[model samples]
Target: MNSSRHYVIDFDSTFTQVEALDVLGEISLENQPDKDERLQELKSLTDRGMGGELALRESLSLRLDLLKANKNHLAPLIDVLKGKISTSFVRNEAFFEENSDHIYIVSNGFKEFIVPIVKELGIKEENVFANTFVFDDEGKIIGFDKENVLSSNNGKVEQLKALDLKGDVYVIGDGYTDYEIKAAGLANKFYAFTENIERDKVTEKADHITPSLDEFLYVHKMNKAISYPKNRIKVLLLENVHPDALQIMKNEGYNVSLQTGAMDEDELAEQIKDVSVLGIRSKTQLTKKVLDNANRLIAVGAFCIGTNQIDLEECLKKGIAVFNAPYSNTRSVVELAIGEIILLMRNLPDKIAKMHEGNWDKSASHSYEVRGKKLGIVGYGNIGAQLSVMAESIGFDVYYYDLVEKLALGNATKCNSLKELLQTVDIVSLHVDGRKENKNLIGEKQFKEMKDGVIFLNLSRGHVVDIEALKNNINSGKVNGAGIDVFPSEPKTNKENFESSLKGLPNVILTPHIGGSTEEAQENIGNFVPGKIIEYINTGSTTNSVNFPNLQLPILENAHRLIHIHHNKPGIIAHINRVLAANDINIVGQHLKTNETIGYVITDIDKAYNIEVVKELKEIKDTIKFRILY
Candidate 1:
């Protein structure tokens, strides 16, 4: 509550999430036949005014004429605005109530609707200066007061000049009129509020562009609901994960930077020095060297299913939580495997190529239907199990083999060994994970056991299948046709060329690891992985984290929570408790969990503790990281 500075805030698209006049048109023109067209025109006028393309006076005149709104529409518009408050503003309602004396709502809108919205926020009615609506004898609106300063162009600058005070002034808004006050040298600074809308023209003239009200409070070092502002946390997203994911992280107020392709270890090390959250798909490799350079890295979001590309051991030691979408894209990979099985069995790739070459032999030489063919699924996990059910539904007798015991789905049989399943089936589809032992799981010895003319598929990890062995088997006619999505090695980006020994084979179907590359799967992964990353960052709840021990924490209420990560050794918790005891800090609650390598502890204490307690906690021996949550 800086008493030396007066705060002037905007109304439409700043305090509320929408333009008040645009919404007023919707309420008043609900039953009109051309309601949509009128709404479009109203929105255009609002944008033009906010963007400085039209004067505020003219924009308001045209919009009011089109709205035809009367006194009857103001109440409903007020009610709609109550529900449309900006999310950032709604969370910081206390800030407005505490600083009611110095805060003012100055806008080009009418006081009829603005008063009701700001009244609940503890804003004094006299402090709220805006245009007053003039009503007719029958309560139908005619026009605004012509003498009101807010009804004219550059009205905010004129209005602020008339209310001359002896303190520094600051303006926060989304419209060009808000910046006009500062341009005239009436205010010390102007902040372009982009929580709901960002006018480029206004932002270019602003001293600072705040993504939300929280950002404004954070920069001023005011007491806010969050212990730290999200805008300060640097997030780097690479490998072109999904637009939905990028938008979600940006809306969360993270300082996000995106790169469309993967980066090598040295390149990533240089870029990851200050990044708090790192996002990637399958291409980028998070090795020990890369993780060592990430001094501020707290979490890594793998947008794809596998975590083999990331170094889990180093992540655990460094107190970095890793999250991956394990099941969101399972159905996508299963569908691809089923489709590939049918395509390779019917020999459709060869026939399609022949047709494209202008040759129409039209003979069923080696084609076969998948109705009675035997289907063997290797490594029956989430994708493999769903594939088993789908393959069985299409009339194939399914068999699966895994090192770990898994229940058979439908009427599918479980094989005792890889040898038994390989020798027994007409088609072998690999669906294993990316563990080191699974590399080259299907090689020369395993392929020799498969039935001759068998249709084969590998939609799993690239290193799981030996490509040369499969090519040799195809040449020997032991395997008639094969489908492979993953490869032994892939280029870092789509711009690079792909070379493989399986290329130019007669009936081979070679795809560039597109088993789970569907739009739907990417969207689901986009929704899932970022949520986990945000959860871990905000509440220290590593419920779905792969490297950290699972901990699901409740929301903090009326207290400050201290999160401490350290090595899993004796007397770690005792040392933490001793530090709190010596500081005379009263503990509300405590939680502790540990894996083989690291320990995580959360301590909730009363807010009255001195700030020096945080310094004492970090000085504990073997402490990896410490943070405070409110």
Candidate 2:
């Protein structure tokens, strides 16, 4: 291994906490209000998985056209970068000072923006290789240099080749161009720097993946080793999660303590003191103070779908990564919805209650079969759509209403409005998301518009429906019966007992938010969610992250799996794979997947891997961590 291997890194999310270019564009167009529309388009393009280069090109051109931002605007933007350097970057300045000669900033982003940030980081200007932004006579940002290789396709690879360094070259970035460096054989190694963004394709091809820069420095053996005291990571596992989840975390070498009951904020804080990782279902209240006292905390695991129990913004500011099981439990929730809908339509709960009370009321008048009945669904996301197909298979007509357009399955009808669906269907099931707008969505007005004696169900967010109004409707014979699972104010910890407003109501079924509480769902979650949490902790792989970047990679064969989870950006995978190819390590199989906030990639190598490769992988910028997974 060459001691002088040049490390080329990308800017934007790869080096910084956020996308500097995107932020610049947003700032440049702040005054032009109409430019906000274009900014949003750029955001969507990036959000929809467009690589950073393309998003930057499209967004930059639009912003420049709108603001004509020049040197003056650049100053404030530079201030933004200087103000918000990634925390890891600020903490590891000695690593940069020591390895300044081997480091290079190779970015397609404008040097005008990159220069100031590099200067602030104390990197010499000569060490930076990026595109230069050309300003016009009015000091306004006008155009870019088309001739610059960094501005073109596979430009970073081309630029590295142009550098003509004798030793190995490694690329670290969060964009497609960074990944291209390895494909072009320009760099010896690529580290998918996922601290900022983890793209699926990029991670699939990389030799190593990391979620934080600290992991990079540690893996590379580039920083001074100080004997720091180990911070104990105590984890709290809550209800609705399979017991195996805690077992798996324990298997993964975590210090886990299980508590079965629920606790308020003060009690939870006391219990979680000296804890680093907190795990919960829908029942845990990860309040602001809870997070504040959880100073040792690095990550959070919401064992269920919704993260409303946790404060997301506080977690982000506190640099805590929150993981949730978005799809692992989808089938469980959907199956329950199908079963509950059928039960409600057939008055099964009502019949069962009567049987429990020793009243054998075998009357067929109120008990109707689910077949041929219309099922109205609110929110056609994963759970709702799956339920639609299952309901249709059972000989029921499905009608769905969603704010956004959704693809219908089977003979499902897409209602133009919620009211229209409410008026037309016999069974109304709620599967809407846990957004703020969904609170009190199904209230008195909507209930009054529903068909009399219509059966109602809510397996989604508890706040989505007005439970008080639902109870009234059920009692008044307007709604024949109801099934309530999720609640607005749910107990935070699992051990805490619950009392519902609709408790003991006639003809109503009350479940403890167990719509996804099937044995299979629990097992799947037990296997997958905790696996993701452990992977993120061990290797920074965010394969199933609900709020992070999306990286989807193909399964690999013989290679030692290297899982990387980073912020979703661009060239991270290219950097990782480039490192492997440079070391002559062949990739056998790979798997990559991502969400809105994290990118996860699993790579397989063909032969026994070296620590050097992992070390080099960690050196890439924006890396969270890299680990060997057997």
TM-scores for all candidates: the values are 0.93, 0.53
RMSD of each: 2.4, 21.9
What are the per-residue Cα lDDT tens digits for candidate 1 across 1-630? 778879999999998899998999999999999999999999999999888899888888898889888888988999999898888887777788888899989999989988888887778998999998888887877788989999989899889988885598889999999999999999999999998888889999999999888888888877677777788799999998889999999988899999999998899999999999999998899999999899999999999888889999999999999999999999999998888888888889999999999999797888888998899999899899999999999899999998999999999999999999999999999989899998899899999999989899988899998888989999999999999898878999999999999999988889988888999999999999999999887788999898899999888877778899999989988988898889877889999999999999998888545568788889889999988765
What is the Å distance of residue 395 in model 1 from its true position? 2.9
Computed on alpha carbons, the lDDT of every model, listed in order, comes to 0.90, 0.74
- Write down the worst ten-residue block by lDDT for model 2: 224-233
Best lDDT goes to which candidate? 1
Q: Worst ten-residue run, lDDT, model 1?
A: 605-614
RMSD of 1: 2.4
Native-referenced Cα lDDT, model 1: 0.90
